[model samples]
Target: MSTRRAFAAACLAACLAACLPWYSVSAQDVRANGQKQPPVSSRGRLPVTGCAGQPISDIIVITQPPFTERLPTRLEWVRRTVRKTHANTRDEVVRRFLLMKIGEACNQIQRAESERILRAQPFLVDARIRVFDDEAGGVRLEVETRDDFSMIFEPTVQSKSPLVRGMRFGDSNLGGSATLAAINWRDGRAYNDVLGVELENYAFGRGRNEFRLSAQRHRFGQDMRLEFVRPYYTDLQRYAWIGSLGGTREPIEFRRGDLPRNALTVRREFANVGAVTRVGPVGRLRLVGASLTREVQRTDEQSLLLTREGVIADTTDVAVPTFRPQRVVRVNALLGVRAIRFVQVQGFDALTGAQDVRVGMQLGLVAGRSILVRQARDRDHFVAANLYGAYGGTRSFVGLQAVTEGRYDRDAKAWDNFVTSGRLAWYFRPAVRQTTVVESEWSAGRDMRVPFQLSLADREGGVMGHRNSRQAGARRLVFRAEQRLVVPTRLNIADVGFAGFAEAGRLWAEQSVPYSISTPWRGAVGVSVLAAVPPRSRRLWRVDFALPVSADPQRRFEVRFSSIDRSRVFWNEPRDVQAGRERTAPSSLFTWP
Candidate 1:
C-alpha cells in the first residue's frame, strides 16, 4: 500500500531468488543436443571473454612520476591497486568491480606519497585503462593489462632536518585494596594518584650523536617516589647508562599488607642506571633481559633505634647519621623458543636474590583464541602452573590457573590446586539488546579452609568459623552472570554502557561444607548504568552507575558511580549504622568519593 512496504517486498523477493539453488543449461549446450542453440564467439570463447589471452593494447597513462615520499598519497596509489584476483561469475564480477572502487578510495587515504607526486605534477590529471586479456588455468584466472603515464616534477628528500620532538603523559589510580581476602576502606579513596609527562628530542646531524635532556618533577605514591630519570640512554645495544636526580620514597619490602601502621616516611635525592635487550614483540615475548638500578638517597642527621608504644621506660637520645641501601637487581631470561604468533616452548626465571630474595617461575601454555571475546572474536587463554615461594604472598605451593580475557577478568590470583574454568560472552546491540556473559571456576586440591565470613563480628575483629588447621581439598565452584547494555549512540555519549550481574558459588569441602563455598551458597545481584566522559575535553563525557546487593556481611549493599575517575559507596564512603538497629538500605550514597 505504501512505498516503504513495496521496497521491503522487493528486497525480500530478491533475496529469496538469489538464495535459491537453480541451474539452467546454456543455449550452446541445448543446441549441441540437436534442439536449438546460440552462436559461439569467433575465437571459440564466450563473447564477454574477448581478448582472453592477448596483452594490453592501451598504455596506463599517469600524470606524474612515482617517487618515495615520507608517507603515501592518492594518485600514484590508484595505479598500483588493480586486483588480479578472479571474480568467478557474472554476479561475482559485478560485486568485485564495486569493491575495487571502494578499495581505491581507501587507498586514497592511506597513500600519502601518491598524492605528493600528483601535486608535484599538476599536469597529470586523471587516469583510465582497459584489460587486454584473461585466461584460466584450472580454477585460477590470469589477467594481463597495461597503462601509460607522465609526471610534472622531480622528487627530493629533505634529510637535512636537524631535530625531531616526542612527548607523552599518563596518569593512573589504584583505588581499592584487599587485606588477605577482605576489602579495606570506609569511604572509597584511591591509594595511588600518579601523573607523568616527558619531552625529548632526537638530533640526526652528521657525527654528533647522543641524547641530551632534563626534567623537573615526578612522584610515586607513599612508597616509591622519584622526580626524574635524566641522562637516560636511547641506544639499542649493551652498556647504555642513564642518570636521575630527584626525591625518592622506598617501598616496604618482604611483606604483604601485613605491616605495622607506625611506619616512617623517609625522603631523599637519588640517581639510577640500567640496560635492556629484547628479541620479539616488545611486551608479548622476550629471549633475554637484565636491568640494574641503584639509588643513593640523601638525608639529614637522624637516629636509628625504633621503639614500640607505651611499653618503653628508658630513652637513649642521640642524633645518629643514617643512610639506606636503595639499590635493586631485576634480571629475567627466556630459554628454548619464544614468539607472538607461532607456538613457542619457553622457560622464564627471575630473582632479586638479596635480603628479600624473591624468586618466581611460571611454565605454561599461552595460546590465543576467540574464547569469551566481546564483539570482536579473538583473545588470549592461558593454562598455567605458577609457583611463588616469596617472602610476600603465601608461602610455597604450586598452583594451577586457567584464564580467559576480552570478556571478563577471572581469577587474577592463583589457587593451590587443579582448577577448571570457563567463560562465555556475547556483545549485543546497544540501546535495545544487551550483552550477556556467564563464567565459572572450579578447583580440587589438598584440604584447606574455605572462607565463610571475612569478619567474625564487629566486636570480635576476626573471621567467623575459622580453624587453624582446616584441610584444604574440595570441589569449589563459583558461577557468575553479567549483562551489559550499551548506552545508545543516539544519546549524548557513544562509548558508555550499563551492566547488571549476579554471582553464586559453592564448595564441597568433604560433605561437611558441601553445597556451599563460603557462606550458605550466597548469591548477589546488582545493576549498573554507564556514561562516557573524555579526560581532556568537557564536551566528551563518560559516566557509569551501579547498585549492588551483596551477601558479604560487611558490604550488604553498594552504590557505585564512575566517570573518568571512579567512586564507590561501600569502599570510598561507607554508611555507618547502629549496632542493633536495622533499616532499609538507602537509594544512594550522596556524600561518597
Candidate 2:
C-alpha cells in the first residue's frame, strides 16, 4: 500500500508539472551574435494624417510561421519539423479579406476595419496594416500577419483512479485554408460516452459565407446540425442572412440534491431562415429582418431508473410536467438598433494577445405569432427583447445586459414560460499588469412549462467549490469577483499569471420540489494558476484549488482544470433572431444588436 501511494503521488506531481508554462530565455535577451540586446520602445499606431486620402500604389503581404528562427538553437529541430508539417496561410486568403486594393484610395476606417477582421480569424495571432509613401509618390500598403499553431490537442483529466477522461483533436486551419475540422471523444463516470465531429469554413465560396456542420453520437442518442450564414462581415456591409437545420434525440435527466429524480427521452427537430439589412447611416444603424421557423418535439414514455443514495430508484412514476409534445410553425419580425464601439487592449482576456472590447448600447426585439399544428384554432403570441450596454476605457470597463422572453397562450389566456435574466460585469486595472473583475447574474422564471432550471454549481452559475452541489431552483442570483496579476517571465513560449477569487450564490424553488425559497446563500473561495501560449492560442489553461465555506468536512477541498476563464466576460457579435424556441434558450442579451 505504501508503494502504491508513492506511485500515485509521483504520477500526480508529474501531471501538474507538465501543465505549467515552459520557461526559456526571451528573444530580446541576446542578439544572433551573442551580444546583449537593448530594450525597444512600446509599439504604437503609425501616423495616418497625410496617407488617408492617398491612392494605394502597391499591396504587400507578409506571413510569419508559428515557430520562428529567432528562437534558441535547442529548438531548431522542433521549429524545422513544425514548419515542414504546417502550411503557411495562402497569400490569396489574406488578400481576399482586405478592404483596400491597388490604385484605390486609402481610408483609415477601412484599414482599421480590415485589421480587426483579420485579427478575428482563429488561425491568426496578430495582424497589422500600415500605409507608407511609395517611390512613385503613391501610398503603399503593408499587411502583416502572424499565424497561430493551427493544430490542437486538448485532453481532460481527473483526480480519481481513471485520471484520463476525454480528449479533442483538430486543426483550426486545414491546409492554410482557414477551415476547421475536429473530432472529440469522451467517456467518464459523470457522463455517458460521446463521440463528435465538426467541420467549419469561414470563406466557403465567392461571397465568403460561413458554413458549419456538426454531428454527435451519445450513448443513448445522437444529434446533428448544419448552418450557413452570410453575416455582417463588415460594418459597411448592408445585408446578412442565415439558414439552419438541426435535430436531436436524447435522454434528458432532471436532478435534485445530487440525484436524478426523473428521466425522459426527447426528440426534437427545427429549421430557421432569416435575413436582415442595414437601414440607416453608419453612425446610427437599424437592423430589420424577418424569419420563418418550424419546430417539432416528442417524448417517449419509457423512463430510465437512476441510483439515489446508493440505491436504484425506479423513476418511471415520477411526474415530469415539462416534457410536452408539440408541433408549431411561427413567423417573427426582428428589429434592432446598434450604437456599438470597440477598444483594443492587451492582457485582458488573452494574456498577450490583442483583444477588442465592445462598448456602447445595442437593443433588439422580436415579436411573433405561433400556430399550433393539428389544432388549427390553437394560437399563441410571443415576444422577446434584449438590451446591452457597456462603457470601456484603458483602465476600467462596465457592461450590463438583460433579456426577457415568453409566450401568451390564447386558449389558456395566460403567460407561459415567462423568463428574464440579467448580468452586470465590471473590470478595473489598478496597475499595468494587475486586473480586478466583478460580475453578478440574476435569473427568474414564472409559469415555466419546460425543464429549464438554474443551479449554483460550478458548471452552471459558478460557486467554485461546489461543483457537484445540487442546489437548483427557478430563481437564481450569483456574484463573482477575481483579482489577477501577471508574472513577467523571459519565456516567449507562454505567459504565466495567478488569480484569487470569491463566489457566492443562492437558489430558490417551490415548496413542492426538493428545495426551498429560503435557502441560504452558499459561498466559496479559491486560487488559480493561469497560463497561456502567447501570440498563438486564445484560450487560457487554468488549475484551481477551492474550499467551500460550509461545515461539511467531506467537501473541504476541490480541484478543477479548464480552458476557459469563468470570471471574464467576452463580447460576441449579434445573431439573427429566430422563432418557436423556448424561453429557456441561451440568452441573446449580450449577443444581440
lDDT of 2 by residue, 94-131 (tens): 77678787878888878887887787776777788877
Roughly what TM-score does model 1 have, to 2 decimal places?
0.29
What is each predicted model's overall lDDT from 0 to 1?
Answer: 0.24, 0.66
Q: Residue by residue across 426-461, what tens digits does model 1's lDDT show?
A: 212222334454545444322111111111111111
Worst ten in a row by lDDT for model 1: 173-182
Structural similarity to truth (TM-score) of each candidate: 0.29, 0.83
Off by over 4 Å in 2: 1-51, 73-78, 159-163, 188-192, 258-260, 306-318, 371-378, 458-460, 510-518, 551-556, 565-593
Model 1 alpha-carbon miss at residue 315, Å: 19
Residue ranges of candidate 1 with Cα displaced over 4 Å:
1-286, 293-338, 341-433, 437-480, 487-496, 503-523, 533-552, 564-593
Candidate 2 has which clashing residue pairs, if any? none
**Highest TM-score scorer:** 2
Q: What's the true lDDT of residue 50 in model 1?
A: 26
